[model samples]
Target chain A: MATILVADDFHENRDVLCRMLRLVGHSTISAANGQEALDMAQEHRPDLILMDLSMPIVDGWKATAILKTTSDLRHIPIIAVTGHVTPDEINRAISAGCADYLAKPVDFERLLGKVASLLGDTQRPPFLSS
Target chain B: MKLSIRTKLLAALGLDLALMLILGSFALNQMSAMNEEATFVAAQTIPSIDTVNTINDILLSYRNLQVEYIINVASADKLRIEGEMHHLEEDMAKAFITYDHFQLDENERATFEQTRAGWEQFVTATHTQFIPSNRDSNTGNVHPSFSRLAPLYDNLLSHVRQIKQQSQQRATTALGRVRAAYDASRLVILSETTLTIVVSAVIGLTLSSNIARRIRKLRDATMAIAGGDLNQTVALRGSDELQLLANNFNLMVASLRQQHLLLAQRNTELSESLETQRKLMSDLVQRKQAEEAADRARATAEAASQAKSMFLATMSHELRTPLNAILGYVQLLHLEAQIRGNTDMLPDLERIRSAGKHLLTIISNILDFSKIEQGKMNLEIDTFEISSVANEVIGIFSPLAHSRGIDLTLICPPEIGLMRSDAGKVRQVLFNLLSNAVKFTERGHITLTISHEYHSGKAWIFFSVADTGIGINPEQMGRLFQAFSQVHHNTFHHYGGTGLGLALSRQLCQMLGGDITVESETGKGSVFSVCLPADIGTVQATRQTHVLHTNGNLPRHIPGSVPSLTPGEETAVVASPTSMTQRDA
Candidate 1:
């Protein structure tokens, strides 16, 4: 299982994201905001960070930019989570050092598939949606 | 006379000549009368006076010679008596000739005739009765006859004296008459000459003042006007050229007054025009500035419009994020509930999921349209397995078909292999079609078919989704792809949706160089097809070469004559017609 950090401002949203990741056989951690997410990310050094870009206290873009600048946290892959799925918003997330983009509310299957691929884990089940 | 100017002048000159002719004629007549008087004195009166004086002298001498003969008859006296006798006869004859020579009046002729008779009787007695009868010494007879001879001499002398007196008196009276006539003629000629002179002077002065002076005044008036004094008037009078000239000058003055008024008005107009021109100049400047400001305002408006369009295209994300999370977790919970076999709550959970998903799709369609407007929606063109895309889309409607007790079928051509086109867009459009087919059809069947097409040197992959259920009416088909429009308003109630799926699907298909067409009728089956032009770059070039190879004929991969795909490079997903998603035609 891959270690995943779930960052979101809404308590219910964070809880749901962590539970989904756990059900998908991923090790989960939770943060209330970008600051907590950034602190947790440095401490845990997770395999992937699910960053909610609209959070308070150093939003996803700033936190991502800071994490990319920090050598210790730079190798930790980030997947920008946003309600804004426009190309410019996606490009903004990627340009700020996110490894990929996921528009919210995230598709469970699509989210898991992207997370499995980015973690480079061979043990995850293939998405058999069709 | 009421004469013209020229006639007046000529008449004055003619008057002078006429005065001269009258004076000349009058003077000539008076002088001729004086000449006649002078000729009468020189030719008749003076000669008659001289003849009378000679008669008196001859009568005295003849009477004295008779007295000497009466005194003594001496031989010398007798001889003197005979000679005196002859001389007395000669003197009497001379007096008669003098009377005849004068053109005498009746008184002078009567006096001459009495004188002539008296002389003839005295001469007869002196020569015959008183003198010797025969040549003897007549002394004796002389004394006796002395009385008779004396009486005869006295009578002869008296007649001669009477004739001389009458002639002298006639001559004096004639001379007095000539002197009176000469004085009267001289008085008349001198007065006529004075009258002529006075009349000529008066006429000359009148003409000079009336004609010449008045004309001069008219000339002066004309010159005054020529010298630019229009107010000057001519001093001319009478019914002549001068008066007419004065009248004309007055008319000219009136015309000049009218002209002066007109000139004043024109000057005022010119001043007003200058004012108007000045106003126009300022107006033009203001207009030009206003135009420039308008141009600047237009430019600013255009820039603001562009900014607004950009902002509106990429609208806010607040409405979607939370909603997305809600739908996402709901789907997860449903999946969890389904796995746990909580069959009793399945329907309720499914309802929540369906509603949430519908709302999310509506939001997503709006966002997708905005992205399209901003030109941010572009297909990723690539080679993709055409049947696999069709199979994947048909698989989405399979569960719906089973739930509704309808057959779901896929008829994919074996040769519908890897086509160079946007696979994701083709799947998206195919998903929309399959979803609509499954949603509309209540009972019979939903069929998905794929065809490989080559036409006009282009390749196409067409996927048709046909459904046998409550079909769309012809009128409803018209606005099938209009955003936010639902064919047959009741479709919205019967089939729950945001009504943006077909429009968004059509837009997505068009973006991928394809179009979706629908065929339907009321109470019959409907067939919806998605036709996409496959990546024509390499295909077109190969087809052109093939056409050339075939000598300008069609390339081989036609619809009825489709070719099979080559093996090994791709996995074709042409399922069996009777697979789990299949239904008989």
Candidate 2:
């Protein structure tokens, strides 16, 4: 299972997204804000990061920028998750170092497909061992 | 006349009175002298001369008469001699009394008396003989005694003549003395009259000169006042009414100066107050304008916020509808693949794939709209044939329009040349309009017309898409060009659209110094017109004259690739052959 980090400000949305990832047979870690996500990303170095753009305290854009610059976190693919998904917003996320984008309320299948595509059944990191 | 004025008036009165007195006294003295001279002339000299002349005439006449009487008595008879002698005696006595009273000088009087005595002696001799002649003449007889006495009478007459000569000499001396006295008295009277006249004339001249001098001073002061010299004073020097007038004039000038000063001060104060009031009023107006400007800014911000909220709601609806299709199709594909032992549902899978693809396109349009709103879209300008672009857009809608029993037509001018513009953006705008026309029209033909017109040394190209379909209402037409606005509330129910196409088209047109306009009526049709500058080559007649090429023979195809079928198609295809084997087992 690939390790995935899901960051969202709303608890219900975060829980639903994490549940979907788990159903897809991926090891899931969750954070409530971009700052918590960044901390988790530095510590666990998840295979892929799912970022919510409209979070409080260091939004997805700034967090993604920080992660893109960091040597350790740069390898992880960050996918932007937002309810307000427009082509311009997606382009903005892509420019901000997100590998791809998914809009909410997310289609569980599309979310799963994007995760599968970015991770590609990659090896799990040692720290993510269950 | 009080204080200064009284002093001046008193002085003026004193001076005038003194002048009057001097003139009057001089005149009076002169008149008195004249009266005294006249009296002296009339009472003393004239009376004395008359008396002296009268006495001289009387004595001389008497002496002559006495001589005549003596001659007559001596030469006549005794009776004639007695009558002449009596007449001579009476004449002599009358002359003696006149001489006594008329002679003023003592020597003249004595001469007059001696003349009278000679007359008396001759009379006495003649009287003695006169009686007898008178008696004889009465008896009517002439006496011979009178004739015989003629020689004696001649002798007596000669004696009487001598006496008469002596009296006439004394009388001439008396007349000469009287004439000398009259001439001396006239000389004295004439000298006094001249003195009085000269004195009166000098006094009148002095009085008139003083009055004239005072009047001239008053006239000068009045002229100075008329000349606008209010400070001038009439300082007349005299003890007369003119001096009092000058004092009053000075007081009037002082009052005028005070009033002028007060008026000037009041005017300055009024002007300053007016200036302050004007400044205050202007400041109030400026403050009011500032407040109005702030109010306008607030209203603008509120309007912007409301528009943003409207955009958000529309976006939510637009995103939700497409997402439902995409998610629903994916779920169906996954579930159906699991149900069949061998799954290959190509048609259902293709529908899912196309739906997903359409959702992607819609999302992309949303992103583009956001970029345009954020002012991030950049145009890439290049030169391309404008007819080709129009042909491509026409090709895109032709299939869809045909499927709906609507004819799609494109008319391009014969030899349109290259146009310099952002080809991609222009193509997008054209595609959006054409596709919208095709989607909205259920029947009836849609035609896109293009033409070029030359105006003011420049070539302008007009492009219009005209459609005969269900059209927009007049009220909703205004809102059609606004971002994310639909024609009616149920517009989404009838036709699915993002509604940003016409707004973006207008924005693009405006960027190129052109604009898009629309004309529409409910159930009649719609026409959208776009005007833009043509390229230089298109403006040249030589290039336009070349044989025009048409796309009549060109094969048309979809510009972008289509996505493949979903996984449901693979399962359905595999499951078909396995149906008999499963039953046999």
Candidate 3:
């Protein structure tokens, strides 16, 4: 299983995301805000990072920018999770160093697919695994 | 002299000639009268003196004969002689008186007076002797009387002789005096005739010469004036009124010369001023024309600006509709790939879709802003249920909100009426607000509230989206509704939205005579409100209240079995293993 980090300010959203990741047989870590997520990323060095864009202390855009520029963390793919997925917002995420974006209440299947595709060589279990 | 001066001079000469003629004629008339009177006196005196001398001679002869007859005859003869003597005495007395009164001057008067005395003595002696004898006797007495009277006759003859002598003397003296008087009268006639001739000749010559000289001067002056030499003055050399006339003519010519010079100068000035005025008028006309041209150009430029804005709006609409289809299909494809476990193409497809969508949104914003500038955006008003619209917008956003642990809620009063507005625009506005709430809120609830009120006989529908999220600052609020404006600089960077939704919503509200407003505190949350007019006739059914409960407390997903790739496999496969392996690679 590929190790992943999920950063979100809301507990319910984090729980739901964690449940979906476990169903697919991926090990996941959770953080409440962008700063916590950054600390978790540095500490764990997860294969992929799932970022919630609107957060206290540091937003997903700043966190992504800092992570992409850091030498040790630059190779990790970052995906933005947001509620409003307008074209301008998607482009902004890409420009801010996110590998891909998913609009929130994110579809379980789509999220799993994006995580799988961004991970490339990292094998993960199917999302519907019993 | 000028013409008038010459005229006056000639008139004076004419007057002088007339006076000379009158005086000369009067003198001639007096001289002729004197000549006639002298001729008449000379002829009458000579004829009277001859007659007197003849009478005196006859009287002397008759006196001698009468004396002889008186001495020789008797008394009868004496008496006859006495009668004859009386007659002779009367005759002699008349002759003596005539001779005395005929005296010429001192030289002729003495001879005439002596002749008269001798004649009177003879007459007296004859009368005394002849009268005495005639009274006595006849023939005898006549003889005695004749002898006595012979001596007396002789004496009388002597007195007669003396008388003849005196008569002769008187005659001679009278003749001499008459001759002298005739000589003096002839001398006077000759002197008068000579003086009349000389005076007439002198006056005629003087008058004729003066008139001729004046006429010549007048002719010369008239010629000079006709030759255009107006400056030349005719010299008037007389003290007559002709000099006054010449002075007046010179004054008239001077005045005419001054007037001519003044008139020429005035004409030149008038022409120059007219030219200047004409130039000024033309300049004014040209300036007005230029101003009119500029005004026309300004109007044309304004018209072009309006046309350009209209073109942009139409092009944006035409372009965005197709872009929407492209992006929507691409998103669907990306989701389908993930569900099928074919995730290798997901990243490239998402990139292409996002890039297209981003360009599309920029085009849409530019078009919308242009439409607003041109005042061409209009509302499509329709009647719709407020609750239904709210539910639809909420449904679209609920999944997103749920994933973020944001509680999204809809609060519509059961008594709320159906709203009348542009349903499409209202939906767009609500959808933007609700979605923004869901995106911004992380741990807090987002609510869509709907209410209705009556004001001034019109139903007003008020809708609001409130969220407990990171709210906007007051400073950023002013720019919140401007096109392409984001509340926070990082909003576009973090949240994915075009940023044109709020601006378009505000424009839509303004079209419907309504507005959108916001109330928020930073770090707490935000509430965006929209007020719209409700349709009068549409009625909404009252909502039924129910106690909603969920058995699993977790959001449910569709539970149909996942299609398996291998028929014999017991576990439901999400995707083919080979495709999953290709995605992982």
Which candidate should be chosen as best, given lDDT against the real structure? 1
> How do the predictions measure up, each by TM-score?
0.52, 0.44, 0.40
* lDDT score, candidate 1, position B171: 69
Compose the digit string of candidate 3's lDDT tens values, residues B47-72. 44653555556566665666456445
Give lDDT: candidate 3, residue B303.
71
- Model 1 Cα shift for residue B314 (angstroms): 9.3
Docking quality tier of model 3: incorrect
Output the number of the TM-score-best candidate. 1
After superposition on all CA atoms, what RMSD does each candidate show versus the true structure? 14.4, 19.2, 23.7
Instruction: Give the per-residue lDDT digits (tens) of candidate 2, residues B1-585.
Output: 223434544555665566556555655655565565565455544544444444344434434443343344443554354454445456545545543554244554454444445444434443456334434343434345444444444544444444344445545554565555556545545655555465545655655575567678778877887787877777677545666676777787778778877888999999999999999989989988998998898678656644654474457645654454455455545544645533567556766765665555465565555444544456565788989999888887787788777778887877877787667766777777776777776666678877765655666666777676566777776667666666654666566665666766766654443556666656666676776656533322111111101211111111221112222212111111111100000
TM-score of chain A of each: 0.92, 0.90, 0.92
Please provide, for model 1 over B79-133, each residue's C-alpha lDDT reduced to its tens digit, 9 standing for 90 to 100: 8777876877787587778668889888778878877778778777766766664
| Number of the top-ranking candidate, with DockQ as the measure | 1
Higher-TM-score candidate of 1 and 3: 1
Off by over 4 Å in 3: A1-130, B1-58, B64-78, B91-113, B130-310, B324-585
Q: Candidates 1 and 2: which is better by TM-score? A: 1
